[model samples]
Structures are given as structure tokens and as C-alpha cells.
Target: MKKTRYYPFERNRYFYGKLLTVRDFESEQKYFNDKRRMMNRLLHGYGVLTGLQVIAVDDKSVSVEMGAAIDALGREIVVPSPMTLKLSMMDGFTNNEYAKNVYLCIAYDEKDKEPVHTVANSSVRSDEINDYNRVLESYRLFIREDAPDPASLPLAGITDQTVVIYQDAHVRVLQTTPRYVNPGQLFEMKLRFEKTLKAGRLSFSYEMASERIEAIHGATIMFQEPQEQLESEYEIKVLLRADSTVNVKGTVGVKEESAILKLDDCQLDLQEQAFGEIQIIKEPVRERLMSDFVKQSLEASLESPSEPCIYLAKICLIQMGPTYVIERVEQVPFGEYVFNSSVMYRLAHSAEYRDETAGQFVTKSKVKTLAPGRPPEFKVNYNPAMSELAFDVGIPVGGGGGIGGIVSGVVDIPIEPFTKINVSPFGKPSKSFFSGEIAHGLGEGNVLILTSLEETSVDSISDMLANGERVYGGSSDVFKGSEFEPEAPEVKIGTIAYPQKGTFRIGVKLQQPSEPFDVRVRWWAYSAETASSGSSSGGGDRLDEALSALREAASAGSDAE
Candidate 1:
């Protein structure tokens, strides 16, 4: 690189002088390009020099341009313009020797018309030891030629060049031109392919918080040969959703296949132009739990009409938010907004769970004009809106002495299950099971149940054999055991259902209850929602206080009977 340096001689006055004894004009002529005019001025007694101008500077040598000026006396004089002087030879110029110093004084002749009175001693000193070293260090290297190489001729008869493909591709983000960008400014992202890859295509995806946007700079791009060897630049523009940082994640894959070639996580830092502060902050999604208590007294009266079973039943109401609310919130392609709540029922006369409003409940109202209809069943009103119902038993299945047993069956009940199985050492083994069907009441959805058998003792055994590796199970508790297959593993069973409304059955049978075990049953329901999908029938009811009053009514009816 050609480096240039500047040295300022802050003299106010200027004059013309000529070299007295130095003889390196040939090297000096290389910079000015015209040797005739310089020599003619020297011959005419007009060559004069005063200040030094830096012409070139490098680690090896410093080239300075020496110049002359009309003296401050306001006298008009014809003199040679300053020319670049290449200073390479370094000797004892400091000792004031003529061989090393280029002394410049006004060139005078005995036959001159007017007497030229000018000092012959204005010289620019060159300290190649200290001053020149500083120039070398401070000089900015100049860029000379940067023309792009012309495209090469294609290989004869070859349609596409087969670049050798290597697995496990790694890429380095070479440069993000204009790392700090305005909200809508276009920026360039340069990625260097560190590993060779076959002819493939590159795709880009941008994520700002939870929102995902496509790269304006063509999301999908085909590879151009030889470009694989050099850094590739892609132009990207983000609008509307701007944040402190935008993650630009991408994957590269072969042109014809679905296999990914590389996964690159790149980020664009932002310099935001803040307009105002946030006025009101609210959660992206709001949730409410709506429970309906249905009195079994009505069903009992309709069925037998002899003995009435007047206990209140619990029902769950799952409904979607109003259309305007869903529209106001941002939605991603495959993203979901989930609100969850669980429902359990307890009768007033049950001793296991004492009801606070036991004796005060009323099964029949004396001032009732008409009997109210029974509450709807626990059906999922929203279709294609996924729901996951998990049943978990908190107990450690102490390692089985031998191969553990597997229990697989189905439980069919009219409503949700109310069974709790107790297999603890100190407690009585109470076997409970409940089966129910959820009439999705809509079309097109899936119900998936995933049952995983996790052994807590695995951690103890793993820690004994563990090295420096960490076991992470999505929790902060480091001592928690990782999920592992046990010698006495519990039986794993599940069923899948498609379509909106379907019947489901569940069955649980304990072989031996010596080792306390934990069981978790999860049910996933997805309901399809569209812009035209209307709200379900049973929704928008607050049930916290209503549940209490319903229990009191049932207790009062039981006491009166």
C-alpha cells in the first residue's frame, strides 16, 4: 500500500531559493514528471525553496515535496513551482554537512538587473530517526487499484459446475455494512463461507422479539459458482417492527434437496430513533378461567324420579377470544396464543374434602319461577386451537427389583375423571380413575396424548458416573435427575384422535404398589380457527363466586332432604 504523510512548516513569510550543492534532482524529477521546466528555472536564477510538503511516507522511506514562495517583501518573482523530492539517503544531515543537507538559497547572478536580497538559510529539517518514524507510523496507506476482475469464460459445454460438497458447514459473518441501522434503512450482510459447499441455495429469516419477518433481501438465493469461495453480500431491509437487536437467522441447503447446509445466527444492532415513551403496557394475551357447576340433581330426577342425586358437577368452558381482540394482536404463521385452567369438583357431603358451604347449599330455590337448565359438559368449544391436559402423579417409583410391568388400556367415562390413586408407603392404596369424552362440537382437529415415564432416581445414578458434563432438563434445579430408562420402567401407553368430536377411553391398573410411582397424562387438543369462525355457545362467564354459591345450594338441598 502506498502511504502518504504531511509535515506542516508554519512559517508566515515565504521566499524563493535554490539548491546550493545537493545533486539528487533526478529522483525528485520522478514525482513532478517534467524535468525541463525545473532545470530551466535553476538556470535562469529563479529556483527557490522554503517549506516542505509531505509527498509520500512508508516504513522504508519518506518522500517530501520541496517548494518556493514569493518573499513576504511583496516582490514579484518568477520561480519554479515546488516539486516532490524523494528523500531516501539518510546520513549526517543533522551535523549540517552539505553532502547530507540540501541547502537552498536564492540563485543570484552578477549580471542581474536588480539586486535580490533574500535569506539563503530557510531550511526544513528532516529527522529520519524520530520525526520520520512518527510519519511512518501515522501515515494512512493509500488504496491504489481496486477494479473488479472480469467474469471468466464458462467451462465449455458445462451447464453447472459441481462444487464439491462437504458436510458440517461453518460460516463466519464477515461484515455487516453499517452495523447500526435506522428503522427502514437498507443494509448489507456479508457472510464468508468457511467451508466448501455444493451448489446450493441460501435462505434468510429475521426475528424481532416474538415476531418473525422475511428478509426483504430475497429470502431464497441460489449459489453462483466461485461465489462460494468469496464472501457473499446480501442486502436486507427491516421495516415496521424495529428493536434494539434483530436476529437474522438463516439456513443453507442444496438446490434440489431439503437438507440444510449451514445454520447461521447473525444479528443486526440498531440505533433507534425514539419518538415517545410507552404510555400503557399490557400483556400480549389476557386469560380468564370460567367454570360452570351443573347439578346432578336434575339428571337424577329425570332418570329415576325416585331417589335424587343432587350433588353439583363441575364443567369446564373453553372458548376463544372475540374476533376483534385476536385481530388486534400480532399473529405469526404457526404461532399460538394459549390460556390454560384446570377444574375439579367436590361434593358438600364428601368427608375427604370438606365444603365450606356444606349445609347452606340449596338444590331447589323456593322463589324460582322456572328451573334453570343443566350446565353444558366439559367440551372443547374451540377447534383447531390446541389444548394439552396433563395428569401427573407425584411419587418416585423406587427402582424395581426386576423388569417393571406395563399397563395399557382405555378409560371411558361420561365426564372428566375424578380418580386419585394413592400408592404411598404410609397411606392406603386408593385406586381412582375417571374417563370422559369432550365433544369438540366443531370440525377438523387433533387430540394427542404423550405419556413420558421419567425416573427421579436416574439423577443419583448419573451423578455417580457424571464427569464435568451438565444434565439439563429444562429446569434450574441442577440436582434434578435427567429422564432415563429404568430397569423397572413403568408402562407407557397413549392414543391419538383426529377430527373434532371423538370418543376417548383411558384405563390404569396397578400391578404392585410397593414402589411409589408418579404418573402424568397429557391430552393435546388443537382447534382450527379462521377469520369467519364465530364464538362458541358457552363462554364469557365468570365462575369464581358462582361455584361457591352452587356448592351452598347443593348442601342446603341435601340438608333439607
Candidate 2:
């Protein structure tokens, strides 16, 4: 926005006993008038102060209501009565391919009239004609291809003198409800026309960048001859999604007579979501192990091991074969041995024999055995008188001579068997394996163990990554689809100020042989407190006072001279 410029007031200088010529008097008058005009321009600013309503009278003319305005040079422009302007009589009203913009503006003109006498002498200036420059203010219509320039004045001597009352275009924007909205939210805009839409196919649509917004309903409306009266106003509605945040330039347009006319254009800001809440569902897990049996059994029994448990046991037995003496032999008794302990065991025994033929019989017998156990104590009951000693001992043939052989014999007997066992806890295992189990369980819809739980925050749904292959399960209300229907927005209708200062614009575009229509314009202006006090005679009273003071000063000067 550009800033308004400030102008200082020019005042006259006075001195004691100074010669006063006609030029000096004129300069004094100019000083006072310029001071007052400067105050008006500086304090109130230049624009229509009241009542300049414009109404279309016909296809080529319009009626303007009586009004008042201040020109750029601080001059008051008053229209005492209503007036009419013809479009064909205005400049730039010739036919063209496109429509032209017509502006009702204040035009400034000056004329040399109102003759007055400079001196009261009898014959000094007889038959002479002197006049004062009179300011004439009237309204004029300017037709152009575009809106009037704000930076450029209408003429060299004029500043904001060309106060535009109104301009005629095809369509004009009235109001927009909720100039901004979140994505996927609905908003509405209203538009007005200066002319009735012709009986034809009328389509309504909003034009914007793709993915920014979409029309849900009310995009098109058909107008028949009977419906032409209802075409003065239109409403456009559109929806913006929640996932999009880019600002959009939306243009609402109407199609008629094979031509598209823009009704309203505006920039809407989309409020983006700062963060989104999300709940993550984890996959299930399952595992199997040998320790599960033991653990379950122990749990059922309500028992647990306090320390490591180990046990070892061993037992062995051996027997000797029956012995016989050679030559003068006597019978020999059999013997047996047994052992049992935590370490190696040995057995040793002796047997006696007597000879009967040679009065002295010599017989000897011995037996020995060793194994992984304690040695055994032996007690024998034998008689020397008996020809042979008898005992309950049995021996097998083909037995090895040493303890190694005896131990080998027991090896085939399966004395004490050696076995190994491993124990491990159930369920706890590698993470990758657990994950695989979870995934497998998810597919089969079986009972699973939860491996992990996670959550994340994102600005929008677009920022989240989706992996279809991974298993997911849970419910979330954040991204759920809505079931209720969207509510319709309220209607809004009003006039908008034009880019050109102090003016309201109305537009219309229709097929050839367009219908006669009226333009409605609402406007406001700047005014000082005294001017806006609703006093109808205040301005006339002030003017009269100034004129009377001027006459009294002139009379005094004439008498002094």
C-alpha cells in the first residue's frame, strides 16, 4: 500500500503601513482561499462525502443521485439534482470484441465569467469587461479497457479530482465467507451481477490449481427464461482437503453464450496442521523350546531347584572257575567276590588242599579280581582232613586274566550307563527370529506374543510411510472417514470497493442482445466532524459569513484611501 502525501498551507504576510496594490489584494485573497482549501484536502481527504448512487436507466444510459465531493484541489463539488448520462455519447464507447469498463467520475472545468468592476471611478474604466475565474464541477463517464490508474491524475492540474462514482463490468464480488479454511474444509463465496443472465445454459465453477480444492456441489445451475430474474446473485462452494496446505488463487466463473466470465477472484490461505497423532499396532509373536515342558511341569508342581543336582552309582561282581590239582591231586573249592563303592575296588583270596596218597598232599589255589568299587572282606570255613574243599563258587570260561578284562565283561553287562542332558528357558530367543514368528502368526491369525510397541507423530498423513507388506492391527480415530454430511454455509452478499480509490464497481456479461439491467453500488466517503454533523445550512452560513467579511474589508479600504 502506498502512503498519502502531506501538503502544507500557504499563508500571506502582513506589515505596518505598507502600500497595498491590486496584486497585493489579490495575493491576500488567494492566501485565505488557499488556506481553507488546504484544510479541506488535508483534514477530510478528497472523495465523495455523501450520496452518489448510480442506477442504470437503460441499455445506453444511467441515472446518478444528487451528491457532494471534494476534488484534489480542495474544491467542493455538489450535484444539486439527479442527472442522467448516455453511454453512446461518452468517449471510447465504440464496439469492440471485449466489453469496456465505464466509470462515473467528477470532471473539473473552469470558466472566465461573472464580470466585476475593479474600481469605483466614474469614467476610469467605463465599458471595460473584467471577470473572475469560476469553478465548474460536473460528472463525466469515461470508458476504458481497464480500471483507472490510481497513481495517475486525470489531468495535469488535477490530483484525485476524478473521483469515480462507479464502474460497469460484467460481474463483481460481493463477499466471501471464511476467507481461509483448513484442508478438506468447505468455504463459500458470493457474487453479484449488474445485468440478468440470458436464457441459456449457465455453468458455475471454481478454477484453481490442481489438488488445492474441488467443487462438491453447486458447480452448475441452469437458467431458463423464467429464471432470469434469479440470476442477479450466485453462490459458489468448494472443498479443500486436510492434507494440502498451499495457498490458492481461486476464480469463480460463469459460462453463458459460449463465453466464460469471471465472477470473483480471491486468494485463500489454507491453515496446515502442525502435528498428527498416530497409534501403531505391532505384530504378534510365538516360540517353542524343550525347556517349556520342564518349566510347565515345575510351575504345576509349585517347585523350583535351589542348586545344581548330580548323582553317580556303580556295582560289580566276579567269580572264579573250579580248580583241580595235577598228579596226586586233591579237590579245590571255588570262590567269588563282590564290591560296591564310589571308587575302584579289588578282591583277593587263597584256597588250601591236602594229598592223601603220598601222606602229604600239596595243593594251592588263588583268585583275584578288581573293579571300580571297594574291596570285599573274605571269611572261609575249610577242613584239612577232607579230601576236597567244597564252596559255592562258579566261574566262566574264556575270562581275561586282569581287571581290564573283568571291567570289559561288566561293559557288556551294562553296569552304570553314561548319558548327557541339556536344559534351556522357554520363549526368550533372538530378536530376528521373534520378528519372523510375529509375522507368521499374523498371517495365520493365531495367538501371538507381542514383541514390541511403538508410536510416532507426524505433521500430516502424507508424511507417514505405509508398508503394505508388514502386518498391522489397531484402531485409530484420527484418520477415520467422516460419516456425517457437511453443513451448508450461510449466504453472504455485499459490495466491494474498487482498486481505484472512492469507487464501487458492478459488471455484467451476457449474450448478444443483452437484457436491460440496473447497477447497484454502495459507497462511503471521508468527512470532518462538522461536515458530517447532518446540518443542511451550515455550509451556506459559512459561505455567507466569508462573503460579508470580504465586503466589509473592501469598504474599509475604500474609505481609508
Among all candidates shown, the one with the greatest lDDT: 2
TM-score of each: 0.15, 0.29
For residues 1-561, could you state the per-residue lDDT of candidate 1 as single tens digits?
111111121222223674433234434433342233332322221112333233223322333333332211111123234432222233211222111112111211112233333333224333222211111111111111111111111110011111212212122221121212333333333332322122133433322221222245444533322434322223332322223333332222123332233333332222221111111112121111011112223222112112111111111111133210000111111111111122112332354444553344222211101101223223223222233332322221212110111111212222222245556687644343333443222234433232222233445666687632331222112232554323332232333344545434333333233354443332222222310133234421323233344345334333111
Q: Residue 338 of candidate 1: its Cα lDDT?
A: 16
Worst 10 residues of 2 by lDDT: 432-441
Error of 1 at 153 (Å): 28
Against the reference, the lDDT scores of all candidates come to 0.26, 0.32
* Model 1 lDDT, residue 304, Cα: 19
Residue-by-residue lDDT tens digits, candidate 2, 1-561:
122222244455678987878788777667776666666644454555666555666544656677666655555666779877664565654444223233444443445666665555435766664545454444443444333322133121111111111123433332222223444455443332222232122333332222343445434432222333434334433432322443443333222232233323322222221111111112111121223333453222222122101100000111112311111101100000112222222222211221225344334443222222324334344556754443432232222212111111100001111132222265322110000000110111111111101122233542454421221112112223552111111111122233223222212111112123221111111112222232355565654454454445434333111
